[model samples]
Target: MTLTKTFNHVDYLWDDAHATSLGDDQVALFLYRSNILGADLRITNYGGGNTSCKTIEKDPLTGEEVEVMWVKGSGGDIGTLKRSGIAGLYTGRLRALKSVYGGLEDEDRMVGLFQHCIYDLDSKAPSIDTPLHGLLPFKHIDHLHPDALIAVAAAKDSEQVTKDIWGDTMGWVPWQRPGFDLGLQLERCLAENPGIRGIVLGSHGLFTWGDTSYESYINSLEVIEMASEYIEKRVAEQGDKVFGGEKVKSLSPEARKNQAAKLMPLLRGLTSSHARQVGTFQDTDKVLQFINSYDLQRLAPMGTSCPDHFLRTKIQPLVLELDPQEDLSDREVILAKLEGAFAKYREGYHQYYEKHKRANSPAERDPNPVIILYPGVGLFSFAKNKQTSRVASEFYINAINVMRGAEAITEYTSLPRQEAFDIEYWLLEEAKLQRQPKEQPLSRKVALVTGAGGGIGKAIADKLVAEGAVVVLSDINKASLEEAHATYGRDQSTYAVCDVTDMASIEGALDAAALAFGGVDIVVHSAGLAISKPLEDHTEKDWDILQNVLVKGQFQLAQASVETMRKQGTGGDFISIASKNGLVSGPNNVAYGTAKAAQQHMARLLAAELGKDHIRVNTVNPDGVIIGSKIWEGAWAEGRAKAYGITVDELPAHYAKRNLLNEIIRPEDIADGVFACVGVLTKTTGNIINVDGGMATAFVR
Candidate 1:
């Protein structure tokens, strides 16, 4: 059959030349097919679906060719699947479990037995859907959660729709939790209908297979395309009647984003009562259409249909009760309504847990919703990190597409609450959660580091990110910012060119922080320059430069950052990288010293003022951070060295000798001091931590 076919939605990505390159390796072909299917969200969500191929392999133990099943392992995404991610099991051993199966109640026990069937000792653990593939007679199988097919599957008349779409060429199975029982049902469905090409799993997904990997892949695309064409035709007939038509108009792009920026921090603060969360904001046209629709109130509460959707997005989203048409400038009103809405959402979640939890169920998870919807603002999704939060948003958009199709053609149906709870609270899933790695110290925190292009600034940014904080690297120099950004890449850090002296530049950087990773949890004011000169030699320009960059710059950054932190209602940290000269008097350092002192005192004042808001302000004083200091690579170094009667090259040794510990302070030392202020000194504020290797003169008095 030709691989090319036109479809309104979904793509035909198969390359015959690439498939042939694998040289008849079934496992490679399986991975290729899995990747192409998973590449498009229209096909399946991240980590949502599974693929399998039964292959003949040489048994390490028996030294004989034996049939083994290789399937995408548990908790792995098919788009990024590698050889190590697939599980290999003996086909005969997997089949033998059917004889020992004691019915639905025996499902949990069957999962443990799959280990005994391992064909490769180093294979990844098999997933819960193992039996769904093992019992099927096809050599290759593709099970996916395509929104088009799921629209048909989640419709009120799902089974009838399946019959209408494929006309007995496809089979339909009612909702059953994935396990041996569901697998048995699939085997029986195929057995009863000898020539059916695939099966539409009610309220779940679709499964199709073939003797060859190419055939199985094409079959899945064909069925999904047919379902999409059917849904599109019906939706066209319904027209504006879909979702009861739009009730509210979408905000202009700028207004919509500004609203999201204002709302995300507040939502993050509310949802983070249990554990701090990182957030992602999405305002796609489809998202706006759904959120602004008349049926949004009714449909959003009905929750997502597919297991993958709810697993990432929670059972249902917490919809804000604000009207988009009303003036959003009234912060007090918005706050009051938000507080009430969140309280009710938490109460409802508790009730859900109480209603369906079993005696053996894991303790109720964070009751806060993972997905939050605003009528005019679109969606905000929160999780432990950026990628996960982004993926959650993508999954919800898929749910929206499914709802669009289902509601247009037939009534959209979610999985029954009890069934959803069973899967969500399954003991097997609880065990899986237990196996995940522990979170890093700064996980779920976002930090914005100014002057991130320079030595001290770059070190601070690197250290914060290494501890699991997503960072925004900002600098006055675009060249330095670009270079620094390249080191961390886009996942952990984003860059903004900012000049602290410019309030607009500072505010723009904070906006970048808020939009890039929800909001800033920590702010490091490390951007500085030194003008070393005697009181008489100090030019007006020198004094102004030092005062503006050091004193005024820190003030503006703090001012802008505080707005975001206050809106977040989450406590935050502000660390000023001051100098020991701020405390100890030194010759030829009049302008720099006075400016540092002002920066230090300003931190103390802010610490006292912002305490009620739970914002901590601290200072890190370093005597000599000259090794990689941008400030030292200029006239300031020569002036300071000349004042001490030494050449610039002897400055490091001279400064180290003056300190009690006699250690040369590096940029990393300053970074450590900053980390201590945020990560270790959580209860510390209005205090100075010196990273000058025990400088007695600079000690806090």
Candidate 2:
């Protein structure tokens, strides 16, 4: 009820009004209304719902006016939708072709049918709900799984409750898997009830249609608002009451994150053999409130709040027993307990599938829990990417909110297990999950980059992501880390505030990376200091700063990453960013040069020792890499310029001219060299690759 109408994006839809075409107006309205609906998580989630508008288009070949339906394409998010996201299909042709598909059909054949019906020939794959939109006689159609309405729709007395609430203003349909038959049945229901504003499918979602996009969107909003109001009144009538008595106590956020820190990796490792991303909701306010509630243990395992959530988050969450007072430091003990719980959950899922799966159903999916509920800690969601994991977490939170409202009014109910299994394992939904593009070279490879806030480190992180790697960016400055995360795509990359000088901080960062992405396959040690001074003038503190970050910190980072790689039985790469000065020292550069030299030497030693474990170790040395960099903007800039016999502004030119190539090396240059060492030169390990614009003194023989 609190969600207000804020559909002020029509101006954007008409930005290029002078060049607008015949059907452009319809596309604009559809996109605008779709964004408005998608903006509210209560109305729709990540990509759960779909929207469409029917219009007339001219066929290029035949020069004939054709009725077309522009439906939201598969795997498209309406919130950030574009013109290309909506598929234009010949509506009349599709409806006529329905007669061609007569008997039982597998989902794969239906995919071919939908693909062949595209009016625009070049449009993306049409959504599976295309038939639903095509059969309806409305100019515009909207289908959404609004959480509030879903709670009412999932009730055992759904028909009765809906009748009591809206009388005959709404139409009720029984649960039916989305297909041609359901589409036909929906059209028939509309034919039977001439003036109903919307249809509520039991345990599914809401469907509304109108002559215009505005009317359809308004109808959807109004119906959802009505459902929300009904739930509020029922909660009031039930009185403020706690259903179950509280026994388990709540822990502070810090304590809970610490607990999650230890548990997330074990859960990730146990979920699958391949790399996977794991996330926790214990820190989320909604999840914390729900987990600490008295009725959490009782309500969690009953069923999902909505049937459609079965695709994103399974039918029910796997609840784990956690003790706040018990020690969790022993990795072996905690790991064993987690493995036991995972085994039980897997066994249960298999049993459920065995009982419900038909003879011709798709092969049993990987028996892994998507959502895990920890009693005292928080909820954890797992997926292959960060966005999907985040979306799953959001749906579960919405589920909790809906269930809280439903249980307050009446006992919360859900579809039977067999029904849920049918929808979850349906070939149509399976096709949706199987429509991924070709995999990239570094797909699912987890990479950890230190000093990832700017310059060479940031460039390296960006490169890794572009090459299809899940990057964990860590920087000492929290602000820089957050900024980098935003720039590199927040959902694809995660940032960690880590102080490399501290062993505990290094270990925590490694743990966070393993928790965020299953395990580390690549480590880039780029955190270092440039404390330049003569050996006689350098203070103990100055020397310690250089050695701590460059030498000691690098050693700790490698140790932790190697341990994780060894445990995963996956060979990895450890690349340290050394400098040209390490090979040829300048005046008053004793500490900086010595530290860089130590880092390179450490890589060699690690290469020799870790080669037996199939881990490659290498170093990239680059100089004059100051473009778009903060390296030469601090107090050291003046000193470094004076050492090179030039002003701060002239230093870059001075160094650029000194090199044989006479080219100013950029951070990207260093990144490209690192990529070559790791990706191109697989057999060339324990070597120094210099990227200093071909400086003769800095060259390695």
Q: Which of the numbered candidates is closest to the native, going by highest TM-score?
A: 1
TM-scores of all candidate predictions against the true structure: 0.94, 0.86
Model 1 C-alpha lDDT per residue in residues 419-469, reported as the tens digit of each score: 999988999998889988999889999999988997899999989989999
Would you give me the overall lDDT of model 1?
0.90
Ten contiguous residues with the weakest lDDT in model 1: 323-332
Against the reference, the lDDT scores of all candidates come to 0.90, 0.78
Cα deviation at 66, candidate 1, in Å, is 1.2
Q: Evaluate residue 144 in candidate 2 and report its C-alpha lDDT on the 0 to 100 scale.
A: 90
Compose the digit string of candidate 2's lDDT tens values, residues 1-701: 12235332111222223323334588788887788778878888888788999889898879999998999988888877788888999888778766777644543466578876788876868876778888888888899988777877777678887787789998888877677767777888899988998888877788998787767877777788778878777766755353343456667877777767666666766765444444544457657666767788777777784655867888888888767655766767877787788889889989998999998789887788889877667788887666777788888887886776667556677778887888888777777778877766666567899999887889998888887777889989888888889986656788788888888888888778756665677899987667655568789898888999999989999998887776555577999999998999689898888899999999999999999888999999988776765566575677788777788888779878989989998888888887887777878779999998888877678
Top-scoring candidate (lDDT): 1
For model 2, where is the 10-residue window of minimal lDDT? Answer: 8-17
Off by over 4 Å in 1: 1-8, 15-20, 325-330, 641-664
Cα lDDT for residue 353, model 2? 88
lDDT of 2 at 50: 89
